[model samples]
Target: MKLYHLPLSGHAHRAVLFLSLLGQKAELIEVDIPNGAHRTPEYLELNPFGQVPVLEDDGLVVNDSNAILVYLATKFGRKDWLPDDLKSVAKVQKWLSVAAGEIAYGPCAARLVTVFGADFRADEVIARAHRILKLIDQELEQHQFIIGDKPTIADVALYSYVVGAPEGNVDLMPYINVRHWLARIEALPGFVEFPKTAVGLRA
Candidate 1:
């Protein structure tokens, strides 16, 4: 397996982190988005979306961060991370959707403004970050992980951006349960840290 990624990208980090947690021996290839490496013909052939974090397992290509997580969980037969049952699968899928949707436009977008200078409404994105975070905090109050007591891909899906939210000026201090939940993830075996950027409120 090979993972094409950018060091600063949270999307890429999620894939890499899951690979590590699964104890997979995969080659890591850094994609130089700064130099337009991701747009090259060779790269686009692997992922037409031209995004970092494209995983190639033999000849099979998996794009999108959440999709890669599901693929790995299913391929490895790790029912703990991604269950085979209908209800459990649906619950994990919902959180993955939250990670992609609310988490993207919220914390991820805000980080883009500070870290990459991408244009976005800072106030709006930060507020959005807090809104989703508040719900997540509430959820964590009842369970140790996102879906329940066991840590799943849903937890992995939401980890990076939420942990790095302060870099985007989205405060994590007020979300105590969310903080404790993050601590639990960090203590997991084979866990990896998301590279930090000193920008936004973190500056």
Candidate 2:
């Protein structure tokens, strides 16, 4: 298996973090997004969207980060990470959608603005980040993980951009429950960190 990724991408980091947590090994191929490597013809063949965190395994290509997490967990039979029951599965799918939709335009987009100079309205995205974060915090206030007590791919899906939210200047201090939840994931075995932004490093 090969994971084509960019170190600074939250989307990529989620996939990388999950692989480690699952004790799965894959070749790490760093896609040079800054130098147009992801936009090249060859990379386009792998992911038509030209996104980072594309996974290639045994002639199969998985294009999105959430998709990669689902694939890995299912393939490895890590039910602890990907539950098989009915209600849990539906809830997990719901959170995954949040990760892709709300989380993407929320924290992810905000971070992109500050970290990579992407042209998104900072105020808008930051507000969106806080809104979804408040809902997540409310849910996590009672449950150990997004879906329930055990950590699932839903947790992995939400972890990256949420952990990196502050880099976009969206303060996380107000969300104590969310902070605690993050600490729990970090304490898990084989956990990995999403790299701080260049600005954060210099600070």
Report, for all candidates in order, the number of backbone clashes.
Answer: 0, 0
TM-score for each candidate, following the candidate numbering: 0.98, 0.97
Model 1 worst lDDT run, 10 consecutive residues: 194-203
Per-residue lDDT tens digits for candidate 1, residues 1-203, read 99999989999999999999999878999999999998999999999989989999989999899999999999999999998789988999999999999999999998998999989999999999999999999999999999999999999999999998999999999999999999999999999999998887888
Model 2: per-residue Cα lDDT at residue 52? 85
TM-score for predicted model 2 compared with the true structure: 0.97
Question: Model 2 — which ten-residue stretch has the worst lDDT?
Answer: 194-203
User: Residues 1-203, candidate 2, lDDT per residue (tens digit)?
Assistant: 99999998999998999999998899999998888998899999999999989999999999999999999999998988888889888999999999999999999998988899999999999999999999999999888888888899999999999999988888889999999999999999999998886553234
Local distance difference test scores for all models: 0.94, 0.92
For lDDT, the strongest prediction is 1
Considering only N, C-alpha and C atoms within 3 Å, which residue pairs clash in candidate 2?
none
